[model samples]
Target: MDMGNRDTIGRRILIVGGTTEARELAGLLVDAGYEVITSLAGRTDTPRFPAGIVRIGGFGGKEGLARYIRENCIDLLVDATHPFAAQISANCVAAAADADVPLIRLERPAWKKPEGATWIEVGTAQDAADALPRGARVLLTVGRQELGPFLAYTGCHYTARMIEVPAGLPDDWRVIAARGPFTLEDELHLMQERGITHLVTKNSGGTQVAGKLEAAVQLSIPIIVIKRPRLPKANAVDSVVWAHQSVTRIFRTG
Candidate 1:
């Protein structure tokens, strides 16, 4: 991937990024002298930015995104969003096709159930809530946006963790505001201190927040894992390096 002397100087790329892979890819492309633009969903109050042009908020929908691609003369489109962000990812696929731009999806793999772990896998957030036992003290690692389904489960107590505090939470539910890469020890301490009986989270993969899975196994806590939503088919890669190479090859061949 010798991007140094390539004809990427005038090539413009658009990255629909929010995950860590997106930031790394943006930096790599920017360093390679490609004109890069990264778009964020604006869901987070303070988001980590990459080393290139950054745009916050959505482009309406698939139609709006295609319009943006055409209007901006984008040569390549990359979607490096969260795995659970199905709607946006689907939109990216449709928009790229509509705009006739080469699209690449940098989606990280989902987490697998650990050995000796009691994982009740479900398709949706509501299913997870329904699968929980009555009067359970649950530790919720699912994002704030996905907390709606659990609200109806008045029989359980929830300790929800997220980067930002979402509004309209129940009075009895506890909230922890923090970011991840939490160590196993930290997870163990949190679960023990809170007396967590069950763990609820999405199988978002990546090592950044995987400590909870190991901790749950060690603590013998039943985990209600929400399966990832089905996304539109696209040219998807699982790693940043692969995505970078794909982008380079597309630029060279196109």
Candidate 2:
């Protein structure tokens, strides 16, 4: 039986992931009958997985990841890390070249202005904080790293949201310990429960936390969206569905 154009080589792929796109990609690869393994940074408290061979934690460094590549016979490498994760992306670039592996990056697109959504742009975390009104109840969707800057902004109450809360968040901060892919009803309720008048988030383009955005618009709360850096030069996809199509295009060598 002729298996027309199908490569005899079953792809041995390693996905470096710590984001929503990574999880979704891993699941899709498994269903596609590809030999896949996923690596997580283990940064979140309870990261939800989409099912496949999962490895939690780092690869030590480029040398370490290269070793794993050679040892496991990794044929393709996909870096689907967060936009802020410059270090990992650099390492992946170097290691893949050294190991002689083909690499692709799954970069989610940054947010664009939408009608009815008023976005105030800011360069830094402090700049975003300065744009907010004093003593106003704010829904802070900007992760934990940047929240410390706003700690000294007096009188303003905050509903600080993170995958996990740190030990030292200011007493004035009201912490919400939860992960995202959040629902509109949930975000709306949070806004209502806390009397939130402002929303602060990065221009992270995915629709996971977009519920809060809708809630902000409906309530007439201003949104402060910190812009993301330019994407590193590499093959990229903006969403899970598009990423699936990308892999489907990988040519099969007889």
Candidate 3:
């Protein structure tokens, strides 16, 4: 869609955001004189706020999102959520279509298995739980929502690390509440101190928290990597800068 003679001065962008890239892109667009609105899932008790306007919680679904876009007159829709957040990404595609707005996805690349690392790639959290052996001391980094499958596996000991401590965890399971961009030294110390034999995580790629993979390799700990869920096709980019540029191009062409 050509926005002929249109400018970025008053153009409004709605970013379906939860990742660092989304936060960064919002800053860029705001600086470029675009009205940016960031939407968060609100699963976390406290989320890192991004520049520009912020809205918390789901859009109901695609229909709700489409209505919001139409009512708010959103000029562009940017999907920059987690790679494994397939539901939101799918919803963004449908909502953008229904609202007749341009949509761009800024998804980071998936993590590749490091050299000499023992990586067991699985399709789902349940598969990762099943792949664990009995008596294993596991480091679970797959987030709180995914803990249900692993809860049934009583044979393994779990040490879950997340941004927030989830309620109703088993008494025996250890919880580490922290944010990411962890150093290799810190990850090594945590794994060694906890006697972690297996590291289970989603392959939500980024330098943030990538130290765990390196730490697992150094300590000879096997890693269970959960594959990313499928998302609908869109104009996708891999970095925040590219997303910013795409928005600029859209306005320039229009």
TM-scores of all candidate predictions against the true structure: 0.95, 0.87, 0.95
* Superposed Cα deviation of residue 47, candidate 2 (Å): 2.0
Model 2 alpha-carbon drift over 4 Å, by segment: 1-9, 251-254
Error of 3 at 225 (Å): 0.4
Enumerate residue pairs that collide in model 2.
none
Poorly placed runs, candidate 3 (over 4 Å): 1-8
How would you encode candidate 1's per-residue C-alpha lDDT over 39-101 as one tens digit per residue? 999999889999888999999999999999888888899999999989999999999999999
Predictions in order: lDDT: 0.91, 0.81, 0.92
Judge candidate 2 at residue 230 and give its lDDT: 57
Query: Higher-TM-score candidate among 2 and 3?
Result: 3
Pairing residues by index, what is the TM-score of model 3? 0.95
Write candidate 3's Cα lDDT for 131-157 as tens digits: 999999999999988999999989999
Per-residue error (Å), model 2, residue 203: 1.6
Model 3 residue 116 lDDT score: 92
The lDDT ranking, best first, is: 3, 1, 2
